[model samples]
Target chain A: MQIELVYVPIDAAAVLSGVKAGEDGAVTVFDGIVRNNTKGRQTRYLEYSAYEDMALDQMRALGAEAIQRFGVRNVAMVHRLGHLEVGETSILIAVASAHRGVTFDACRWLIDTLKQQVPIWKKEVFVDGAVWAPGEPFPAEIALG
Target chain B: MRLEVLFFGVLRDRFGERETLAQFPGNSVADLVRYYRVIAPELGELWSSVAVAVNQQYSRASAPLQNGDQVALLPPVSGGSFRNIHAD
Candidate 1:
């Protein structure tokens, strides 16, 4: 079980490492990307920041929950802080299990819970301006203002 | 009592990179914010605009405080990127 918060150049190398660790039973991975458009504006990039201390704790809890609920084996999740451009993998989550079913279930739960609970916030930088990306409890993006 | 306070992003720029001791008659989150305002007025002006977390959970200014609480003050953030994002 590994949950990390790092500031690195985004790439698939981490995913490859995850796959190598599990040795091919079953591995599930998901990458959250920066979209080109948001709220009718073109998004150039995003700035992600976190209250590192609590953000890390929340991530660890989600990983533990996945282990308990899905009975999955090894797992690795990493999220990059600072800035990122379009098409980058802002967050990566991978779950491994002896069978594919457990891996799939755990993977879904990990991402689902992350979106709902993680303390990290993403600000979408549009072509002309910017906006604060609301978080879990508030979820401003989903609600009409 | 004084607790270690961490300021991030624009907040850091406003208050500068130094931890100031915040005195509280009662060690609660409300007192912390009040001390912050007394210490840095620029920070105080921007306080309500940003979000806060106590220990670790996203909390309000009035959240309860503990003896060794690791309090972080975060400004309105522009969070993380997808994959092919730019460098800051």
Candidate 2:
């Protein structure tokens, strides 16, 4: 139920707290962080940008889908924008459900779907150069000509 | 009509700007591409593989565009990774 596109570092603890519910038996979190290298190149940092309005809308859709598909009670997703250093959290997803199994399944589904569908881009700055990381193509239905 | 087109990631770098206001002569996304080709040929090469978003949703090249519509050229999404605790 909480979806944000933030420039500041993601507060994973705060996001997790938002997903807490007394009735939910389990909560699963997927925390994505910035790494130090890509394909053997030493990364200096990363710059993330988004079609912000669209990205937020797409994220909201993902959270809603998780609720409908997996019967999860709450879904919290936060994605960071702007520059980030190594070891910084980039994205976080927390899913609460009545059972542990559904929580895990929903958490996985949310991140996977967000990666493919959301209009967010990241560029890796290596010591030698900076390049945009090639991403997976969108599904046929949503892809433009 | 004038359309405000946004460029992101590599596209932003290619255009050397984040957003632009374009004078669109045609109605569809393809028309916008054609217009851009005349002004910036380099962008044509990159446009072939990009996905266009209209009003914050995935849109097709054939989708009609109106004045003041917000169109964004999305290169690709390199997000959401668990490998080595980082993003791609």
- Put down candidate 2 lDDT per residue, A26-45, tens digits, no spaces: 89999998888776789899
Kindly list the per-residue Cα lDDT of model 2 for residues B1-88, writing each as its tens digit. Answer: 7777888878787675445566657899888766666776765546666788887778888999988998877776777754423334
lDDT computed for candidate 2: 0.82
Instruction: Give the total clashing residue pairs for model 2.
Output: 1
Q: What local lDDT score does residue A5 receive in model 1, on the 0 to 100 scale?
A: 83
Query: All models: lDDT?
Result: 0.66, 0.82
Q: How many clashing residue pairs are found in candidate 1?
A: 19
List all candidate RMSDs to the true structure: 6.0, 2.6
TM-scores for chain A, candidates in order? 0.86, 0.97
Q: Candidate 1, TM-score vs. the true structure?
A: 0.71
TM-score of the second chain of model 1 compared to its true counterpart: 0.69
Best by DockQ: 2
